[model samples]
Target: MKKFIIAIDGYASTGKSSLAKQLSLHLNYVYVNSGSMYRAITFFALKNGLTPLNKENIDRLINLLPEIRLDYRTNNVTGISEIHLNNKNIEGEIKTLEVSEYVSLVAEISEIRKFVVKIQKSFKNKNGLVMDGRDIGSVVFPNADLKLFLKASEQVRAKRRYDELINEGYTVEYKDILENIINRDSKDTKRKDSPLIIAKDAVVIDNSELSINDQLDIIIRLINSEL
Candidate 1:
């Protein structure tokens, strides 16, 4: 069997992570959530009072980047992977509305993007892997065997995000999530460093009306053809 590097890129809350996880599991490949890496950094900055609103503070956060260690550990019971920051499991903390509010700001920094890209690239050398993020296909792994760019309407994406957050016990407003999604879309696409652009050879998937099984079936059929 030929292993593949699967890169899934899209705007925030487009179900990129969910799709990548399922694809990886179905193929017994490694699933990597690239956005969680940035969120973890954003979470660390906020906890340490290094808000991206202050240019100097953002620089300080970059300076302290050497001390930041990001990794993943799979849970034995559920066989699901969790993001780890400096050996602490923070999968739960990084998904909050607070992290979403500032993650784009943190990710807009060139140094931060570069740092995360380096880690993202390292996963490719290990085994068959599926990575999902804003820039995974366009920047992190341009030569990936399979590249998928997922997209959805802002309203739909926001609603999906709102429901997920609420289910996770976060008190969030739909309007706020919509605004954040819009802001992130602008920042992610307009940022100078590794802006979220679809690769020339990537397949675009508008999954706004598609169910999880429908989406996965589409991707699996594509993968089978490739194999």
Candidate 2:
């Protein structure tokens, strides 16, 4: 059976990662969360004080790109791939709201996008994979066999994200999460490099009212037709 590269692109908290992971697992393909890569970079910047407060700091972070290393390792207990940065498991740190707040800023840097997009494209040479991020379909894998653009209203996405964070024991306000979602949407769409845009040929799924199983079924049927 020939395998297809699946690219899922979308705004934050639309469940792109969850959907991509499920698709990859079902198809026995490698799953990569491209956003996690950016988050890892943001996490590093925050820890090292290379924040985007000024151009000088952003330039400093850009210069240190060569020193950063990112990879995924399957967790024995969870049986899911977790990101490793600098040979340490920073996956736990990368998903925090702190990283979320900074990831879009880091992702906006053309240098950072170029750095990560190179790594993202390398996965194509290996085998079939499912990758999801803001620019996966538009920039990283423009020729991907199946492209999906997931979206939901800002209120829905923000509620989902807030619930996720709260479930993870993070103290957060719904209003703050909503503001972050709105801010991220603005930044992501306005970024000069690889701004988040639906590919012309990509299928769009507005999953605000769809259950996970329903969404999965719809996508699986589409994949089956493609296969």
- Per-model TM values vs. the true structure: 0.98, 0.97
Best lDDT among the predictions, by candidate number: 1
Which pairs clash (backbone N, Cα, C closer than 3 Å) in model 1?
A: none
lDDT of 2 by residue, 131-206 (tens): 9999888888888988999999999999999999899889999999999999999999999999999999999999
lDDT of 1: 0.91
State, as a TM-score between 0 and 1, how close model 2 is to the true structure.
Answer: 0.97
Residue-level lDDT tens digits of model 1 in 1-227: 78889899988899998888888888888888999999999999999998746989987998999999999899887576889999999998999888998999999988998899999988978678989998888888888999999999999999999999999998999999999999999999999998889899999999999987899999999888875
Instruction: Tell me the lDDT of model 2 at 112.
Output: 90
Candidate 2 regions off by >4 Å? none
Q: Give the TM-score of candidate 1.
A: 0.98
Task: Say what the RMSD of model 1 is.
Answer: 0.9
Error of 1 at 227 (Å): 3.5
Candidate achieving the largest TM-score: 1
User: Global lDDT of each model?
Assistant: 0.91, 0.88
